[model samples]
Target: MSGTVSDYLLYRLNQWGVRRLYGYPGDGINGILGALGRNSEFQFIQARHEEMAAFMACAHAKFTGEPGVCLATSGPGAIHLLNGLYDAKLDHQPVVAIVGQQKSMGLGGHYQQEVDLPVLFKDVASEYTVMVSHPSAIRHAVDRALRIARAERTVTCIIIPNDVQESPYQRPPQVHGSIHSSVGYSEPRVVPKEQDLRRAAQVLNEGKKVAMLVGAGALNAADEIIEVADLLGAGVAKALLGKAVLPDELPFVTGSIGLLGTKPSWDMMMGCDTLLMVGTSFPYSEFLPPEGLARGVQIDLDGRMLAIRYPMEVPLTGDSQETLRALIPLLKRKEDRSWRDSIEKNVRQWWKVAEGQAMKEANPINPQRVVWELSPKLPDGVILAADSGSAANWFARDLKIRKGMMASLSGNLATMGCGVPYAIGAKFAYPERPVIALVGDGAMQMNGNAELVTVAKYWKEWKDPRFIILVLNNRDLNMVTWEQRVLAGDPKFPASQDLPDFPYARYAESIGLRGIRVDKPEQIARAWDEALSANRPVVLEAYVDPDVPPLPPHITLEQAKHFAEALFKGDEKAAGVVSQSIKAMVEQLKPHKS
Candidate 1:
């Protein structure tokens, strides 16, 4: 009970069920690092950068649904954690960020490595931000940060001055005696009243066609969602964040929405007369049914998010499961299957088109084929993390999340460089499960590739060293190049968009892990097999075609015109993209001879 404040803080973290702390050690945090060295309950994961530490923490919380913990030093170190912290905050994941500060005497003197962290972190960790100035206040501050992080599902910051961390415990016994941390926020289920349920049910019953749009908040209520979908005869469309909420193979479920979504999802949303938005705050209003076109009923646990995206006639504020259970009985089962059947037909056709796209062979391997091949090969209960950009497009469209598998990306923040760190965190949380990071060449070089060393360092500690990094080595910022062609009628800017090639496989091998490079399409499966079979961390670098366009399910005339303009302007890759698009359209338009 009597130890340095650093010891007390670590003890409280352990008590709160944080077994691993991801961080980069710095001079300002020497006291805490020394305490960590002496402690066995908590393991310190040394990340190459403070940003990766924070990203790993965010990914841990995303995978485990527990408050993830990270640490960093003063000034630049603390600032480095912001992007990752914002990822946790925007995605509504719980995270506790502990930062070290300069000595107490350097408060406003502009000393080295000194920044006013409390004020700086205010916007990001709006839930709670405290600087522990007193040895006696350590327990209370740590407890409050943890509790608020859990309850609010947001980031919390705890700033500790170096001197305070090393200070001996001089507080009275009563201060420590009063502090008790609960497992989590124990709030009663917020189910809607019968009247609200009846009203929501009435709205759904009145419409001839209803579509259900779900998000991550409905993750635990998949069965209930199915029941509601079955009763209302509604086709379900998932937000990108909710891709894993329901199995992609479900007949009535129309994959993801927005630019990354399937044709069926877009069609269903556009055609529905009534929309039942469950546990989602999907920000793109244009992708959703127009305000006047469809009557909406939104159900969300947080009242603040209700009706934030679309116009809702009925807003049901409660837990997704509890509210759905209450409203299910009140909903009238639509006897007509016409609406659902049409959506199913579209879904079926879309999959065929998608498969064709994934299988198309180019001079260099098509990127989609990589995901398509990886999908069936993935073992059950696998954890997959995707980086933003072209890699994410492949993951969103091609990867299938079976019942037991978990997949995550920087959904709300939509940031890059999270893929490797997220995979590392998932591996740490479930060492027995196979973890894979699907990263683009640009993203890998940006910040993800460095984490390979961290994985190498921790490989020996894992029960199963099945951490695989699938690098789509396309040698260009392919997504941005495609966007320029399709959105701005501009050709690829070689200087800005092109990336110098790096030997990712060799890099992995140099770090004492398995590395396989695939240049031909036929070698992709073999490379994946080798990587998966390896007993340690492995990198499978597939050199994909930079010319293949990541086309959306449906293409607009304007987009086509932009591509044509780019082609006319001497963009060498434009002709190939147009040919690909025309081929896909022809396939889609062709009749099923069956």
Candidate 2:
């Protein structure tokens, strides 16, 4: 017995456990949508735009760790989905895009909506095929595409001619079930040498004040790292990406390390008698310190990464978890708790200083103040998709993500326009969690607006728990301006960088969503209440002073010098210019200082 390929495809998709699909309906692809509607378990959500459908699909894959589906019609409709699909491809996300093609009659000769979709998508997709006369091959094509998506962790494409979509048939395609999980570090495929482990053990035993620096790789060994840190009475500092994985609230834990890093984390790293580098390969060698005095012991899966920039005293190649597990017993316990307490006290002092001085001023609200205010109102276990610039830095430091909040940005791709789509994906994977897109005005205007339709689909899908868009609207590229003054040494810019200011809140309002503009400092509470109270998509556009800079909780004297040197090239004349900028910054900081 035979059935319509569309029906078989739908049945196969159900078998794969794909419940939600993002796309828009058009004349050429009506049959595919009709087939999808027959099943109550699955949904083909109509998006405002085709590109948004691809974006939503990408986001879904990121959250679910499965291949997300995007459906589209012929020609222009499918063409609009390219950029978002590229994002998924580059990010190594699994997505399957199904596009409608003109009927077989339209082939070879000129016909309306007649573009070759399979050919068009060939480069972007991991695999692609067009089904015209081959009805029997459709099931195999889809199944093959699913396997590729699952294995390669990339996008796949399937083009079905209109006639094939409406072809006569009897039985639906056979469905199959799969139980796939993250390809996380599997069995300790490799282990470290006993000598290397012993050397690290020897150094830690010898050190009086030791601190363990954790990176993303340390996530699996968090418990082990914590155990060893406790044994040595060592303070723990992590990189920004390592935030959630590490024990943040622990007494011995210091904040992150870098320019934005708080606590005396960097100092702790430099001052420690032995610096235990657990699953980290941080690049900034200047900030890393001399490997000789500190005796850096780096434990990593890719042992070559250990001390690639700087030489290491102990380079152990193995699974972070396994190596850490083995080394835990070897470490001798320290009686003194003074070192850990001192770091904790420093963190508290710094926190108080930042909180005090960083409030909105009399004339206007600071961008940092906007972030500070949003910190509390953020939904618990909410998802944050951050862009590269100052917005990410601000969120990285201030947004208290202690117990909840899922961060999509793992490494430093830090491109603009990730927030909306990232949130939508997080929402797709975790239907229960309230997904949030915390975006800055400059960043959002770049790529985020394209994904608004994805959020709209969520609103239509569920009347309650819409994607909340908290936009930090400072009306200028504040992050870039700071980079120019602080890093580039040039505060001057062309007119184009100064973007056109608009009523973003009003535009969101016009789009059938609640758009509340918070111009004054006091309006924040009311705006947040409306955002939290409402069950629909809301855009909180907080107008802030673009000139107000974002400073991390702590900065070392050397980092300050680096900024000065970068701007002025160590010229005495440039000293005046750099000093003036620093003075202005210090004035703003004074209000927050203890």
Candidate 3:
């Protein structure tokens, strides 16, 4: 049988090396669905919701460094993809979204599912988006979407009308007006100019104290970064997206930066005389060296993102790995070891403080302890995904990323309900590796619970069925509650902040997966051990105390004032908040030495 345009679209995707698709089926995509039925080659992962599918696609891109493809029906299905697509856009991952629209003739008549998808997707898929109005258009549309998405490392869209999808496939005619497009893209080796590398090295070489900050863009450049850091005698700080860029075992590698950052990272940024930011546009300018205090040199693929956060003396626009490799020869190894020694000391002290905070007693369970205990238990080559909210705070600060592990979250978009989907996507990419999702109860309720069913359906097929979802089952919007006190000086509004309790572990048990529930602190480690050894996927729910605040590395005067004001304003948990805040603060000084 002659293939339809829908079949041709799948063929084009296969040619582009797309082996799997993450999406939910809908009536509007009936033609594509039929084509999928005919083709048995592609792995179509059916997520419970369209949004989860998009997140899965984004995660696939992040983990595999390939352009993730997602499918959706028009209108609402398309609308649901916005949040996850925005996540990929802000984080700069390549993703291609294929959408099904209403009949072409019905677009202007306000027919059902007739959305102006191009307009709807303009911002998210700003690199390229097109509606295939003709059968010949499908070829160019699919080709362009994949190419543009790969080249730009951004989202691109192709909207196919149902009628056009069902139409007989046609190659573009060999005429002047007809367009021809092809598959396959290879990244170019991009290195900064020799003069630019030397100029940047001169600034770095002249400094007495240097600090290095890296992000997701530096994930592939870890070796180069380590060499540079060693030569400069500098401390390295990781932006959240780059948590796994360098292992925490390095003496000079300070953990995450920004609000959820470690004290060592904050201290290194503040005290450094020179800053070398590689492949990271860490947004918190306040957390960086105060403007003119430190001379900066930044390396980024896009020149536009180079010096927006700090005033870089030299901005090298090139690939992080290639640029650093070139810049290495120009860099002189610093003779002074005092700066490096101080940084290592600080790193050691900060780890102790983290232990103190984690071990501090809470009402039932400390959220920090849950992740801290699991950090050492994490399998080699494990992949981690963390949801937004307090779980992210704990994941960022408590978990120690090893050399081979990979971890990511909704970094720029910081959306909830991404942890489960991202973990699922990671498992799909590397079924042999263990995968874990750290989720807050709010996020678990939002969408994680539903995705558990998806996990239950697919876990048996994975090469190593060791997937774990560790839910911090605190019955409150813990992050926002603390934010209200520390940022807005407002009391926790129970009507908005409080959450209904649900049996997450029991629910997992009901779905034929291992379930572990822990309220006592002593059970945290045992629960993690049991979940990791489980034959099937497991849900480990830790009922943590919401009052144990996720304190910032350094508290500001304004934040302190706000905290006092919130307490004065009759916050119901004022005593607990005050007590916990003091305990966390005291841990900074009384770090439990090993």
Candidate 4:
């Protein structure tokens, strides 16, 4: 009276609340994929590559606050899953990675698809465990793995042996213990006294170049923080993860600050004599110049992050939203609009010079232009998951993100295949809102974006189209050679670009999805329209110049100097170019000339 192991797995997965499994199928894992197809609640997302599938699942977990799941066959297939799984671990996403093992007996004997997955994934997984040979023990191990992934907010790699996967008579899945979000509730750490808010307000009232800096923890207080900034005529800049905290058009916002920060943001941070660090644990203490440069005050839910980096003159411990409300009334009337106008001017003209060029440029299409086209078309508050390299730069410079449109562009960890998978996570979290997975063809191919099929299969059963992927298909390692030639100072820097002309568009189309490819400038709109109209997964292959760089709004005097010293060292033209960028930054800091 027993059924196939595949059917049992499907039933168990449904019980585990895994509506989607992003993966590619092979001999070891084909049984699971076929079983996935048979079920109504569970579906397989056949990824273009193992990494993308893992990345997609990671994205699903980030938003959903659940354990995102991905599957891969043994050996090389499982090896490709590492990059994205590691990315998930760093980004604080919970993903359950299932790798098909060779067999229980030949595990260490070195078969065709043999790899000690448990050992390989030990460091990456917050928890690692192997599957049970007995059908009765299967559900508990899986349930336990899911718990570890969610509770620890890290990846959990589980090795399912080929025999176990192909076996029959396994028990059905069930909810064992409690499953909940990792959102911690520390003891009311922020009980900001009335006097603290009063003092913080006093500082804001008196300062000339007053500014606000927001981080991930403070993201929830966006509106109230905006209100406080408006009252004091302050400028705003964000930590890396806080880029989308406010609307791109906000008057007081300068941009981000760090190694990847905009020049104007650095200038404004230096310009301001006083700063407010609201709800953030920005750890770049060295970047925040010495204590004399500015007097900083911070408000945070986690008091530990308040002064962890830079020392604070006035530290107000309270809930970000509550603290802002309590302090709003104590602010004195400040009449100067110059600082606000300065940032506005900087944001406006810089885009005009940089992104404007990209938008209007003709043939040998610009990547920036593709992103620019996307910005206006996306719904307000759309969460965009951007990858690293030229692709990240293009979207950062050209995409006009609105307030509350959360985006996470990880630092040099720069995992290329993160975009499409991240979109899956964000979509899982906010199913009602639009989530776009943006990436370049080079990076996509590197990470293996074939995971779209995995998502498509999942969507078919769930009847949800939470993922929309827009790929800039330049068909080469565009960013790699560009960084070497442009940033790395290798004039004779030979490009590492080598890619095949595959039918990426046709591939997506075959799977009951929408695919559009635009090689020419004029075709962008029509292709975009076709992709946008579909209420399912959309694959947009925008062919742009393989070597263009995405420049920020303003390059500072300090930054330009560094660039000259590093790249142009003895060259006058490089120095002149650096000089011009500084001049532009200075002009940016000026009052509105327009």
Sorted by lDDT (best first), the order is 3, 1, 2, 4
Backbone clashes in each candidate structure, one number apiece? 0, 8, 0, 16
lDDT (Cα) of model 2: 0.69
The most accurate candidate by lDDT is 3
Tens-place lDDT per residue, model 2, 1-594, is: 345778777877777777888888887787787787776777766666777678778778766667888988988888987766877776666888888888887687779878877678888894555454556656666776777776666788888888888886433345454222212211335677788788889988888888777775665676788789888878887776566556345656676677656645766876777777776666666565566767667787765577785576788888788998888878888888887777666556555554544563633555566666667777766666665566676666666665555564524434566667667667667777776667878867876665664565456655347567777776667677666656655543635456667777787777677788888888877787788777678888888766554554445475476566555544322444444445445643553322
Model 1 CA RMSD to the hidden true structure, in angstroms: 2.0
lDDT of 4 by residue, 1-594 (tens): 266666665666667677878887888776677677667786566677788777778767655556788999888998988888887777666788888877788877867868777788888884656555665555665666777676555688767777877778544445574232222222343458988777788878888878678875566678887888888888788776667777777756666665445656766776777888886666665456556777778987655556777778889777788888888888876788888778677656555554445654433576767777777787766778887767777565566678667787554356776776677656655666776777777656655355665566555443346457777776666566444434455422323455665666677889887778788877776766666667777788777765444344444465444454544444323443344334434444545433
Q: What lDDT tens digits, residue by residue, belong to model 3 across residues 354-419? A: 998999999888899999999999999999999999999989999999999999999988999999
Q: Measured by TM-score, how close is model 4 to the native structure?
A: 0.73
Q: Any residue pairs clashing in model 1, and if so which?
A: none
Q: Where does candidate 4 have its weakest 10-residue lDDT segment?
A: 178-187
* Ordering by TM-score: 3, 1, 2, 4
* lDDT values for all models: 0.88, 0.69, 0.93, 0.68
Which scores greater on TM-score, model 2 or model 3?
Answer: 3
Which stretch of 10 consecutive residues in model 2 shows the poorest summed lDDT?
178-187
lDDT value, candidate 1, whole model: 0.88
- Which model scores highest in TM-score? 3
Candidate 4 Cα lDDT to native: 0.68
How many clashes does the backbone of model 1 have?
A: 0
Preferred candidate (lDDT higher): 2 or 4: 2
Off by over 4 Å in 2: 24-34, 48-51, 71-225, 232-240, 246-248, 251-253, 256-260, 263-265, 268-339, 360-363, 377-379, 447-457, 463-467, 552-594
